[model samples]
Target chain A: MRHSDQDLRTLMRAAQGGDRAAYRAALAALADWLGGYFARRIAPAQVDDLVQETLLSVHRKRSSYDPDRPFFPWVAAIARYRWIDALRARARRPETSLEAEPPVASPEEPVLARLSLDQLIGHLPAPQARAITLTKVEGRSVAETARLTGQSESAVKVNVHRGLRKLAALVESE
Target chain B: MTERLDMMIDDLAAELAPQPAVRERDGRRAALAAALVTIALVIGLLGLRPQLVNGVADALVLVTTALFALLALAAGLSAIRMAQPAVGAPRGGALWLFVAMLLFPAIALVEHLVGRPADAQAQIGLMCLLNGVGASLFTAAVIVRHLRRGAPVLPEAAGLCTGLAAGAVGAVAITLECGGSSFAHLAFFHVGIVAAWALIGRLVLARLVRW
Candidate 1:
């Protein structure tokens, strides 16, 4: 259900007051938003980790939140910062050279080709699609994704690796 | 053109906007403040003797202590409620209440300052100044904590109120001990202190609390 701004504010205030349930609800609401956000840039596997880390940070520093303002902006700002930090960390590590390139669609390409890929991605199971998006697009570490998705780190790594192979096979057959 | 494609991408990106995260840490801070106030009140009350008890002192100490404890309880309750589900969470009124609580100490300071003999007044003034500095330190800590967590100014009103409550309680305690109860002393001391606290609270809220 769509939560009103007032509802969210009340929830936030409660969360600030040390309500675990309120915090979870707030986290759930934020997860959806963050999921879509990570889907665009990072692989699906990494979104869960980013969300978890962001939530932990939010929890650790919750006392600084102001009750008067909208809660989402504060969350978004945190997420943005977290994303930047992750990017910076990746840049510093330089271990993973296998980055997913954004799809390069030329003007001359048929609309059907783009449509087919979108449809194919959509057709994948939600978990698989999410794993692929986080790992390939968002470029989050497997451990981070596992932590966010509530799966073991090994599971996340395997899922991303498997999901990518399946997607590549699908594209080749198509 | 590529511009149109970029615009579409931008629109899609905007559509997938991420919501901000919320953390519940105010309750902990409030609890800490409450605990501190309770401890302070206990110490202040324990220090009181019949000889130290004046009319103004009695009134100030009793009122400030009780009010501070009440505010502490309220803060604690808010913190408890914050731990619940979003649907079950309490309102933001508690924050405003906390802000109101911060005003009490300023009132006490003014009351104490108004009635003392000039020689005694200087000592009280110095003590008040010292207390003010301590309170400022606490306020600074609260402000920094708020900023780091990305909390807005409105929620931190509790911290402001906590300060006020502490100030009011101390002022009242001092006033009672000093034997000043006249309307002029009460007005200049209690009311004036409250007003000053209000002003300071407003200034802090505006400058530091606003995200």
Candidate 2:
């Protein structure tokens, strides 16, 4: 999930130079990368087949890799080309792809969430800011914030709207 | 999926054969050599047209042959580059060659209307067209086979380049052997190689270069 470009390139170079261990490691890293790549677009069962196909393709075209250029684009191009071929073949025999279940994002790459609510909310006018921070950032319901802050439910909604607009403008201008 | 891919990689690693240390530029050199040999064989077997000796003295004949020679070089280089996708897209040299070949005749036709020596006669001969087609198919098949072993990503572009490479050779053959100076004859007989291949390259390579 966190392989660096230099590390991958070194592994590939060693692999190209006939180091079996390096080759195995490179393939391992690539398989991990491709799992996340395909999982986002395809069913779980389909990911393995595409990964296998892409690995085989990359191995075949290893000689074409230019040492001067970055490796990921060349590798990704082969994967995309192989995927198109698979799509074309599957289209001709439609029964193969139908058996797979629902698609899902890759479990290997956990999605991270980061919100800077305090900074954004601080940019709003004081009353509107308080309403937004209490409802959105502090996880309070509008009715709860209205009762706590002595504002009507409709007034809380209007303040929250104004707060969101200011936050969006500040973020956009930056 | 991870387990299956790991097993697949192990199989691949176990069977991994050492690839030849060929540089990207080497493909271009190899393709050009192949093209030259094909052109040579075609010329030797078919024999140059008897008019070539006298025809070379003519300005249009020199111009036409020179144009096709450039086409041949461009198409050959493009085909080789296309074999290695990382190098970039195949050059548009073949397309330019085609446009020039088509444009030259129209210019000649206009000149004929103006009483200049356009020599725009129409000679319909299936023999040269058939010969050009045969040579083009043969040359293209061989080069494409070699390129396919390299696992070209853009089979269609590679196929078009293959056709152009073969067409370049066929164009040379037609230019060397055809005695006709007619605009229609040269367009239909000589330049037809590029046109035919450009049309069929996509369909043919889809099957031939399948992943």
Candidate 3:
């Protein structure tokens, strides 16, 4: 659902003046907008958490919003601030890094492959990179690659096929 | 998740009461008033410099006092605006004013190194430092209170501006009462107080303002 800036502003103005219905509508509209906003910037799994946090911030800092101003810009600023905070917090977390995933291929795989191999693999998600490296690059049997990467043999084949397709797409675009 | 969000919205709406929108001008006005009151109290306790009363305060004294007043006004307004954050809000000219205010300390350091006859009065200097810091407390409280009432995106920047603004207020309050004309005194006691407050704002006030 989309809300016009004017509609949001009017609702916000009334909300500031203690109109409960207007306040609820305004917040609901804001929550929807915040969902879309964060979905564009972060992973799907993280979007809901950021949306909730931004809404909480809006509720606490409602007084900071001026009735004369456009409501979206003010709300957008709060969302951006929360997004930055989330990004900083995520950066500080060591367990979330791509390197934390299972190392299926040998450490010397990068040296033997083309210089762009690591950079291309870096573009893929961790699972895709691990699957493609083990089954395709290392020429390991599908059953062995699955066992090493802790995936089912079928899942391993799917990831390698998807990863190669994405690599091809990336190379063509470049 | 949708159900959770709906519940949250209901809860927030239920708790809603009439809330006045935070105005940047109001925060600035409150901080300015607090600074003015502190200045008056400090001046009342320790009378104006003799030269100022005689209408013959030197060029350096007049200039330094004026700089402090300007810095207080600039940084004070900037701090208030930061509390009411907006996307792409242009940071005001407080940064330039702060840079301008540093000239005094640079001059003081040069003078000290050149070995000019020391105009040292350990007791008076220490008293001015304490009084300068004391005068800033109220102004900083007013600004920080305003910050708590709103949402500041860059809390560290807000805190630094708060310190600069409050320190400048203290410097303005004590400048009229101080008779010290030496660069070292102005640098150490006046500008030093502002620097100390800015550091405190960055380290201490950031945590207070963080959401």
Candidate 4:
């Protein structure tokens, strides 16, 4: 069942006072909300992990909460911050697979991932985007990517590194 | 997934202990205390200016000192509030104060353009600049240390505020101690110190505060 903002706030306020039962209940409810929040922003396979990370952040920063303020925005801000962190991590990691891995992969699976990647790359300059797509996303060797893109191998490597760094910075700014 | 979360929640709940909620005032008080401590240290090491001690400091110098003190109060409190990460938190007051603080540099620039440069005291100005930056280090450490205890969503902005507040603390101390009252001196050394810290806070402190 969905808990109202007031219910969560009341529970959280009690949790701050060392009520373990209230703390557990509030956390459970927040977990559900966080799941929904992450599910909307990230791949389904990654949503659970993001939710867990955000819940940990909530636990760590619980004391930062001001009881007099509305609770939803505070938690929401934390959730958003965690989401940015997830994006930064994704931007930094080497590409693993073009196709979606199964079990948790939706039918729309890797399409969402590709679309999001395209959206991020779309923000880059044309040469940087092409170089990154050919080298990183397509997993081509630097020499092969250079041959295909008509750029030097060093240029391709530079573009890939710079592109990824820019992507990490973009995620950071978000 | 459900079981893992349930277990995690159990662990967190089990570890939970009673603690006071972090108040906005706590950060403000800490920043104030850090600024005071730095001021005291500067007094001990460099000694307060004779003009200030003799009550002969001109109105412009006194006004400049007041501005630095006010900026430190506003930006220091705002930086602390940023750590708490509330939506719609009041930060504009500090921003406006920072903008006002830029007037010193602007005035200096205009004066230079008009060929009205003040007598340059390169040696004293250099010393004041170094002292101002040195003074900022302690206060910046205090605020950033407090920030490390909490998650700041806008880490870059929080870092900027931290630098400004800390730099202002340094400016306040050095201003009270340094004898120079020239706009060029105030702009280059006093406000310049704040600018330097603001950059460090934006670049370094942001990385440190990011969770």
Give candidate 1's error at residue A129 in angstroms.
47
Per-residue lDDT of B1-211 in model 4, one digit per residue for the tens?
4999999999999998976678777777888899999999998888888887897868878888899888898889888988786655666676688788888788888888899987546668889988899889999998998888766888988998999999999999998888887778888778888888888889998888877
TM for every model, in the order presented, reads 0.35, 0.69, 0.78, 0.81
Clashes of 4: 0
Quote the lDDT for B140 in model 1: 33
| lDDT, model 3, position B150 | 91
Q: Individual DockQ of the candidates? A: 0.04, 0.18, 0.36, 0.48
**CA error at residue B160 for candidate 1, angstroms:** 4.7
Highest lDDT among the candidates is held by which one? 4
Which candidate comes out best when scored by DockQ? 4
In each prediction, how many residue pairs overlap at the backbone (N, C-alpha, C within less than 3 A)? 60, 0, 0, 0
- lDDT (Cα, tens digit) per residue for candidate 2, span A36-126: 6765433455677888878888887776665555777667667767655554443243222232344334554222111344555567788
lDDT of candidate 3 over B1-211, digit per residue (tens):
3998999999999999999999888997899799989999988998988888888958877788898899888888888988886877777487688777677677776776898635645568888888888889899999999999999987877898898899899998888888887766877778877877888888988788888
Model 1 chain A is weakest, by summed lDDT over 10 consecutive residues, at A104-113
Instruction: Flag the better candidate by TM-score, 2 or 3.
Output: 3
Residue B179 C-alpha lDDT in model 1: 37
